[model samples]
Target: MSEFNTTAFQPSLFILTGLRRLAGSRLWLGLLLSLMYIITMVGNCTVIHLVRKERSLQEPQYLFLSMLAWADIVLSVSTLLSVLKVYILGLYEIAFDSCLTQMFFIHTSSSVGSGILLAMAFNHFVAISKPLQYTTILTSSRVTRMGLAALLRAVALMTPLPILLKRLPFCKGRTLSYSYCLHPNVMKLACGQVRINILYGLVLVLFSFGVDSLLIAISYVLIFQAVLGIASREGQMKALNTCLSHIFTVFIYYGPLLAITVMHRISIRSSPVAHAVLGNVYLFMPPMLNPIVYSLKTKQIRTALRKSCKIQRS
Candidate 1:
């Protein structure tokens, strides 16, 4: 089959196929997705609010935490709107330009979120691995600059992606199989040679996602080594506890991401519903879980939440 004619070329087919297995039930999928989105919004907002309201939490670390929460909020809103359009409105067809726009923002948000996580990892490393330098290294001004730089890097790196996609001639099926415009899904529709596009997409995966993940792993390794060097048992325990929130958040973000990447690579004839569901999970699940994980795992956040609730009650 031509690249455009592959089974994966059909956008909604994967989604419909998966939904059919649920006894042809769109209502159930819609309901479940809606509930998930609501939870995601509430959880992310709570985190942002707690960080802002608590005076003690006003450190450089929590500031980054707030930015991460805001990114999740944006991602959740975008995903929810698109999913609702697909499930409720039955709108499956997307224009070429619209697809490019959606793909750009989705990719941008995903990349930016990953970058922010890396920043968080670095912050923890400084705090745990280099205690004396922590104040100088993570000053408010420096954190602000770093946060802006990460966002700018995401925009610069991903901006070319959509433009390159738009230049391709999509001679095959214009109808996207998935609800949103993902790079692979859209690339499948290109009538022209897509070798370059494929290579570029792979490069993006490697550099943006793969490289960042490796760096995070290395940072944690160093952190662990430093923690081990501490003479006091209580000090080691405290350092480990400090790293817990970032570790949990990284797992939540990277786990579904790796799953979706694998599915996209190996599942040649996967159903549209399967792709859609997985894509949604990869994009939104981390954001959804982040607030809950940090709130429950971090002592500071838990205390802030309790205090926020008490103040609200008054």
Candidate 2:
């Protein structure tokens, strides 16, 4: 296979690369990324462990929550590896095959995370709206099936992305401004028109992120309606409290996502630094915040963590 030379096509003013060049040193970025990765790993792992050990939380809701934690773990690890490869190893240029592999995992993890969130929403919906049927509707087998389905859907949806990207001729710039090989960044390198890649990406985004988000919204809407119909203020408050963690997490995940989309579409001269910063937030912020949200909101998780700590000390 003939590889395209990318030296001449390098952007003279790639904002992300320029920002990294000017913003002190790669050392700082490496240290920051490493610290964040460590925190994400510890926090998400703790959440997963607590959920797994707690007999009370061994239900469908917690099952999906654990899946979300696993997705975050995968995403955080892949992202950290890519960042370290660029900033610490000083290997900014990626081979075609390596880039494709990275893109595959990144997209797969993202899609899986979104799917897990939808499963969580459905769990909440059944628990709240159809309490009588909740147990029957979200059985252990059903939860397992949903999880497997989410994984398969994520992989199947993203399988074509890398192949499509590989088919494009990188006759243009090869230096991806960001630390990782994101779809948009890779698409920018195509010498030939990439209408197909863009269209396919948009379609996947709609099905994966956009559709999942909509379902989450609908789930919450119905949940809220149910809460409102309850006569007692205490009942309403309790119902709202159950969902606060999910709401916070959804916002953290989607806020930066929406910003990235708008920036990509509207901003002609967006800085690579801006994009990179937003990209990092979009990927890591939810994982970092999720544990905090759950810990603060759920007294059960906090008590479980304390008990787990005491057990570890013994």
Candidate 3:
């Protein structure tokens, strides 16, 4: 608690404060998380496999979907061991260096997901606005480049966060509020100069989520404009129908995130249980639901899946 402790010291371990109120129910909670993890992995992997194998799914949007699926897989994997350690193994101690690496992947993958959503919005806009030029505009190489750009941008922004915390001396007790290490939560344990950490974290959020969400909104506006200009009612419905799954994915991914971010800012008066529940939702819901949404809404994906199943039987 000493602000004057200028002696830079790195704690050997950090404790995770994971659903402490539910200590008696770790077995049930662990089982639930395990099921969610399995579902998320299978769902996303199926999406990726279908997109890669199906000739009918070689379009720009499906390619972006596979990218998002990959990101979701990474995000879920990064937290799997740590989460299971807390819930299943009754272990809360994480090595400091391991904590930093975990946070790095978690933040990077989440940001990449946001970036992919932005790319998807752009894909929809182009397809709806200029159907004739859609394939020419979003060529395969171009889609690959967009996915790579998202990953690179996330790495550049997040690489400094752990390094910044590494330089500071963590005089405060090394207990993180969530099951996983987040930059904001980890930085709070440092007693040394952290104004830069706070400022940079804020900047990172604004630049990544804020800017991406705004651009996505703008893209949708343009898409709706294009939809409105369609000559027939059936045409408008068909065009808008294409976006239903992505729109639902966006809501599942960002809604809990935005809510959790707001709660963190005012968490002094918030209940820990609320944080625990919402945090899990923000992490687990999107990955688990994305494939299901697409399978149910997209005719091509459903048809391809059925064909694949029938082929497997034969």
Q: Which one wins on TM-score?
A: 3
lDDT of each: 0.77, 0.79, 0.90
**Per-residue lDDT of model 2, residues 101-214, tens digit only:** 877888898888889888988887788788899999999999999988989999999999878866666656556667777777778777755798888888988888999999
Candidate 1 residue spans exceeding 4 A from truth: 1-21, 175-177, 270-273
User: Which window of ten consecutive residues has the lowest lDDT sum in model 3?
Assistant: 1-10
Deviation in angstroms for 23 in model 1? Answer: 3.0
Error of 3 at 237 (Å): 1.1
Q: How many collisions per candidate?
A: 11, 1, 0
lDDT tens per residue, model 3, 121-180: 999999999999988999999999999999999999999988898878887898887889
**C-alpha RMSD of each candidate structure in angstroms:** 4.0, 3.5, 1.8
Model 3 per-residue lDDT at 76: 97
For candidate 3, the per-residue lDDT at 127 reads 94
Task: Give the higher-lDDT candidate: 1 or 3.
Answer: 3
Global lDDT of model 2:
0.79
Tens-digit per-residue lDDT, 1-314, candidate 1: 24444323333322212233445466777777778888889998888888777888988788888888888887777556567766666654555556677778788888888988998999988998788999988998998887897788878888988777665665565655555667777777675667888888888899898988999999999999999999999999999988888888898888888877777778888876777677767866788888888888878888888888888899
Candidate 3: list runs displaced more than 4 Å.
Answer: 1-8
